[model samples]
Target: MPLVNIDIIEGVFSAEQKQIMIKKVTDTMVSIEGENLRGVTWVKINEVKQGDWGIGGQTLTANDVKAMAQG
Candidate 1:
């Protein structure tokens, strides 16, 4: 049985992106494990508080990461 847990900051991905992610993850597991595909499950999607997630001592939201990457 292959189980996947994906965690991310809130408001980052749209519905279509999430669906594609699920499909890709499941397909990869199926390809690698064959019959084990039946046992594969996407556990949960968690939205963490911005203040709870940090890098270099500063809390970061999803937008912050995007902004940083653009610069």
Candidate 2:
């Protein structure tokens, strides 16, 4: 069994986006681990509250990420 944990700031992704991410992650794992492990593969998506996550010593939020992406 393979357990994958992904953490991101809350509100950065929509429900559909999250689903796509999950699917892609599972597919990637299946590709590497083979079909048998698909049944036991686990993917966890953790969303941290805005301002609660920090990077480079600065607290970041969803909007900050969006702005960074656009620039």
Candidate 3:
């Protein structure tokens, strides 16, 4: 079985987007590992608190992420 874990700051993605991510990841794994593993493939998404995630040496907030996306 193949296990995939994705971590992102909370509120960065909507429910539908996350669902798409899960499906796409599973499909990719199936394509690479063969159809038989489809039933055994696992994908997990973890959402961390905004301030708990950081970049460089600074802690990041939701607003910080939004600004980064705009630039």
Candidate 4:
């Protein structure tokens, strides 16, 4: 079995976006590994609290990511 784990800041993406991510990631994995593995491939999206993720010694929040996207 293959597992694809995705971590993102909480509230950064909507439920629909998360579903799309899971589907697309699974499809990509199956395309590379083979159809037989499609059923066994797992894509998990884990969400961390907005202030729990850190980078460069600073805690990151969903707003930080959204701001980065805008610029």
Candidate 5:
């Protein structure tokens, strides 16, 4: 079994986007691990609350991420 965990700031992604991410990640794993492991592959998305995730000594929120994406 292959397990993949993805962590992202809450509100940074829509529900549909998250689902797409899971599917894509699973597909990538299956491609590398073989079709036999598809059933045992696991992909999880973890959300970190806004203002609770920090990088470069500054807390980041969904808006901050959005701004970065825009740039």
Candidate 6:
């Protein structure tokens, strides 16, 4: 069985977007491993606290990551 885990800070994602992400990730795993779809297990989404995460010695909020990526 293939196990998948996705971790992200709390935020709003449309249901359709979540489903699509799951589908694409699972499908990619299936193609790579040649495993049955039914054998795959997707773990629940994990939300990390902003204060608990850091980048470059500074606590990184969700907005910080976005802003840095855009620059």
By TM-score, the best candidate is 5
| Reference-based TM-score of each model | 0.74, 0.95, 0.88, 0.94, 0.97, 0.68
lDDT preference between candidates 3 and 5, better one: 5
User: Candidate 4 regions off by >4 Å?
Assistant: none
- Residue lDDT tens for model 1, 18-66: 8888788877777777855546555456668666788789898889967
Each model's lDDT: 0.74, 0.96, 0.91, 0.95, 0.96, 0.69
> Judged by TM-score relative to the true structure, which candidate is superior, 4 or 6?
4
lDDT by residue for model 3 over 13-70, one digit each (tens)? 8899899999999999999999999999999999999889877889988778778889
Q: Write model 2 residue lDDT over 1-71, tens digit each, in one string.
A: 99999999999999999999999999999999999999999999999999999998999999999899899
| Candidate with the larger TM-score of 1 and 4 | 4
**Model 5: per-residue Cα lDDT over 1-71, one tens digit each:** 98899999999999999999999999999889899999999999999999999999999999999999999
Candidate ranking under TM-score, highest first, comes to: 5, 2, 4, 3, 1, 6
Q: Highest lDDT: which candidate?
A: 5
Window of ten residues with lowest summed lDDT in model 1: 35-44
Flag the better candidate by lDDT, 3 or 4: 4
- Please identify model 3 stretches exceeding 4 Å from their true place: none
Ten residues in sequence with the least summed lDDT for candidate 5: 30-39
Q: How many residue pairs clash in all the candidates, one count each?
A: 0, 0, 0, 0, 0, 0
Tens-digit per-residue lDDT, 25-54, candidate 6: 877888887766646556355668876777
lDDT agreement of model 4 with the native: 0.95
Tell how far residue 67 is off in model 6, in angstroms: 1.6
Root-mean-square deviation per candidate: 2.2, 0.7, 1.3, 0.7, 0.6, 2.5
Candidate 4 backbone collisions, by pair: none
